[model samples]
Target: MKKMTRYRILMLFSLMIVGITAHSEPYEGVKDIALRRFPWLAKALVFNVIPGIDGNEVFELSSVKGKVMVSASTASAAAEGLNWYLKYYCNRSMSHFGDNLNALAKLPEVGKKVRVVSPYSHRYALNYCTISYSMSFYTWKDWERELDWMALNGVNLMLAPVGMEGVWQNTLRKLGYNDQEIAGFIAGPAFGAWWLMGNLEGWGGPVSQSVIDQQVLLQQKIIKRMKQIGIEPVMHGFYGMIPSSLKNKQSIKVIDQGIWAGGFKRPDFLLPEDPYFDKVADIYYSEMKKLYGEDLHFFGGDPFHEGGSSEGADLAASGKHIQKVMQQNYPGATWVLQGWQQNPANGLLAGLNKDKTLVIELFGENTNNWEKRHGYEGTPFVWSNVSNFGEKNGIYGKLQRFADEVYRAKNSPYGSFLKGVGIIPEGIYNNPVAFDVMLELGWHVDHLDLKKWIGNYTKYRYGKSNVNVDKAWALFLETAYSSPEVNQEGPSESIFCARPAIDIKTVSSWGTRKRNYDVAKFEEAVRIFVTASKDFEGSETYQTDMIDFVRQVQANKADQVYASMIDAIKSKNAGNFKSSSAKFRQMILQQDSLLSTSKYFSVNRWLQQAINFAGTKSDKANALWNAKTQVLFWGPDNNPKTDLHDYAHKEWAGMLSSIYLRRWDAFIDREFAQITSGNVSEPDYFKMENEWVKTGELYTLKPLKKRERDGLVKRILANNQ
Candidate 1:
């Protein structure tokens, strides 16, 4: 019996050694595996999982060994480990893995080092930062970051859909629309945000010919770079949402979207059955071919996003008509639709060719309406997350839900429909951990060890791996990254457009107003964040993200102090008031200084601070008066003329008004006598409150209009007088 046991143990040890050698040795030296079955997956893997593997070497699956299967679990683990390793030794940033989803599908061959090459590469400088507008007009730095991220994560296919405006312009002109009318259909540079949001019309148009020309040139460059790195580009496709200029020139019944607030008219929806539809489609395709060439197979466009009306027509027929035009223009083209907010109407889907359609299940974890409604619906789909909105600063997501959803999708009856996973954040600069984790899902398909993954990520992000940082990350996973019950937008409220100097009376949808956060946990996170910040502070990526994290912690701490003052005031203890008032004043001043010191303070934070001070009701009417003045004077609406700025200002103004209303009502009930006796009189108090109320009402009724410069100047002088 002893001899038999010894023999068995020797056999087991030999097998273990063989397994380790088979799995690790194959991937040695070769570095990048450019898998052709899923070329995109290879790109994503290399770019995200192995930051330093950037060369031209296609890795075949036959060379992979051991348990090198693609699934959420495996991908997540690999990404986590890769992130830690890169940060620990390479001193390089990882890209959001793209295309690597394919690599996760099958096990690779044993005893070969796989170096996957994808079209995507990383830009060291483009660490996540607030975009002035949208990514439609990417700068060279933007392209570099995108490419770097691609190479880091191993993405071989990229969606370069810019320069379509020029394509559409030429298409419209050929179909008899005048330059002015065609230009009216195009949006301005700043309006890209709204256009991407699927919310507004081409407000700032007619687009400058110069801008159109620039975008055309830009797309050419983007495509060239992507091709060099082995990434296939997905260009823009036509889905019948044409400029209204086509209405008179073509025999088509136009579906007008009315005014897109701000007095801008939406593009007219061209009927698919219209004779001109065929002509326009041909023109559009010809121009696309002329500029981008006929090498592309994938195209993206959505008809009637948000709340588009499809009245007076058969929705199913309309969808079929649109697809027919696309097929006729570019045979075998893949159509991409954003499964966002009841879009790609059910009737529309009924008419699409299942094999040709690629549905993006945007906001999958947040809202599973798509999966629940059409899990077995046969069309190939990819899971995605819109974690951030308007790139607002805040932390909120369904982390576990991400893993859960991928698991459910993989095992569902429509499992075959689940093609892969992706990250579609409105802003990619904030919540690096969330972004990292989400991308990792593409490589994993089962239960993932999140702790190990986080450790790996910390090592890569910090450039030098440390156990202390690893422990800190573990704490972060438990605290900051821990799932919250509420639906918050991002990690912290953006102070860029916050109501200036307002006390947070109510939490925004993004969870910024909550004062009951665990300070001890946050403090732990701060220590880790500060440590990581120190190491990467010199790197541009670190400067953009880590410095911001430090400032956010400080601001959040100050917010807690402000929240305490409000609690004290509500306590109604004169003794507490006597002590708390001075402290509150000091804290408010300190917060103001801290806010000013930060170069990138969000408007939301500024507004919250002002509101908090006003809401305290300390120092009789002076506090309220100052709060009210600051809110009304420095409101986001006081910015330059631009649709993006206008939208921000309107939001800030509404928040300020809401805070003022709450305070005004409180004062009327608590200090009516002071007002009647003229002891607390401000010349414009009544007018300001009334005007604020009116503005808020307007925002509710319709989007806020840009305040005219002369009118604003007059109001300012009147308030002073």
Candidate 2:
């Protein structure tokens, strides 16, 4: 009876294995597309192991024909591997998944049960925000968009490292780091923008401990979801940088990053050679393993990301020490470095294990140093673009260069070391098309028809199928998407107050204003934008985007008029000044209205530029002095003993004082001129005008009465309303 039971158990286990394998086949046509687009990548990575027809679908592994099916566990691993391959090679671009999935389903050999995983929630309200301490995770809707992109382009690996703060806190505490220290290390919620930039440090904190704890739980959920979809998670790794509190208990050398000029001490950098380094590394990794599990193969961290010191140590040796500790703790671990701003010292690559290191050529579209240096002497590298800054809304990119460079890299002598491509923007919300085009490039290395691809993209992005929308996109491609020679990181500047808006008389860093922009081309682009806006007139997203686009159009128009005025000023042409100032003021007023219309827009930067332009154009030193003072109070970066409400009162006082100073000067000059002319009416005129000015001044000085103060409060609050 025991022998019979054992035989039955063996048979049951076999059936279960076969059942799991039966359901885990790759989508039909995925392998064919993968092989055709990325022959080298497919050759190295794809592995097929099945040949069967359950219905109309066919099953194959790594392009091979077989029936040695994949179990659920094996399928999950394969998915992760695929994701890594896609991100590393393709740069996490997006594509049309709905059409691709439908096409896959229609294949004669594909089974009805096989379906690509959906990362979206059916209800939009419930999934609009990703629940996490870190806001980097896409909300369910965004995740669905990403998943659709992934499936269409055949991405199986994804890096979902959202909500990792709690994991770090728990780990640090185990290693004897205190709450104060941990708090200092973590960034404030809003400043995640700068934290990602490797700029600014813990400016918005002391973060609540509850937030950290919440992130830990959230990360577990994120990892689980990613796993189910066959995407791999790349967790944060320990580099030598840490919170200043670590210095108190651990004997490690620290470099103060100095105050970032915003009244906060920057995070300190720890030296890798310190004896305490290993202890910290162990605690960090051990904690990561305990919280997220040890299944992850890739880790991301960088030394001296934006700016830091390697003053006392050998740069090469220091890098090796850091990598050595990471590898010792997690075997076969991949060390991911961002090739940003000359940090990680090219010298450091010499000491690190070449095969285990991965370099992200972070600004590939803008910089070619990674390829030029040949991955700093043969370290594996991937091309990437930071296409956006501060994730600001605007449309711009080196479209042709994106295609040209990727092709060049693939055909270069150092091509073998080029692993893949990626998009690493500080803000990922804008530029939907740029992201789509970049990711799709990974799936198609040859015979790329960009126009057809964009036509499909237009339908998918708007979540609709419309002919008019397709026509609008074609116009957009011809205008906004057309490549320009300017070495800009993102879109053209708007005349709005968030960015500097100088008069044409003043040359910007890019040289002459006329040379900076092509007015004729820009006008055409604006027309295209207006036409596109008509199609999505009622869309909230479209309207929000239009607000920025319209301002940019206004700025471009102002630039042309301003340039002509500046030339007239230089030629001593006085007639244009009044008209020029009126145009400038019109631009300012237009921006003010836009900013007032929504809480989203701010005009601080524009105000500062106006002040700068006034100072440069006016000959009188006093005029320049007044403009500078105005900026100090009203500029975006101002700190007048409190927040915006307090600053507004102070600004009103400053403006009154400035007007009084100008009036006082005029009074003295007028009295002198009247005395010189020997006119008796002069004394009477001076007395009358001076008395009126004094009355005006007295009215301004009358201390704010309760009712008056209440009115002011109402007006201030009304700005938001």
Q: Give the range of the ten consecutive residues with the poorest summed lDDT in model 2.
A: 120-129
The CA root-mean-square deviation of candidate 2, after full C-alpha superposition on the true structure, stands at: 14.3
Q: What lDDT does model 2 reach?
A: 0.49
The weakest ten consecutive residues by lDDT in model 1 span 120-129
Stretches of model 1 off by over 4 angstroms after superposition: 1-91, 94-137, 196-198, 248-251, 259-264, 396-398, 492-497, 500-512, 515-519, 528-546, 561-721
User: What are the TM-scores, per candidate, against the unseen true structure?
Assistant: 0.66, 0.64
Give residue 368's error in model 2 in angstroms. 1.2
C-alpha root-mean-square deviation, each candidate: 15.4, 14.3
| lDDT for position 354 in model 2 | 87
Candidate 2 is scored at a TM of 0.64
Backbone clash count for every predicted candidate, in the order shown: 95, 25
Q: Candidate 2: how many backbone clashes?
A: 25
lDDT (CA) per prediction: 0.51, 0.49
lDDT of 1: 0.51
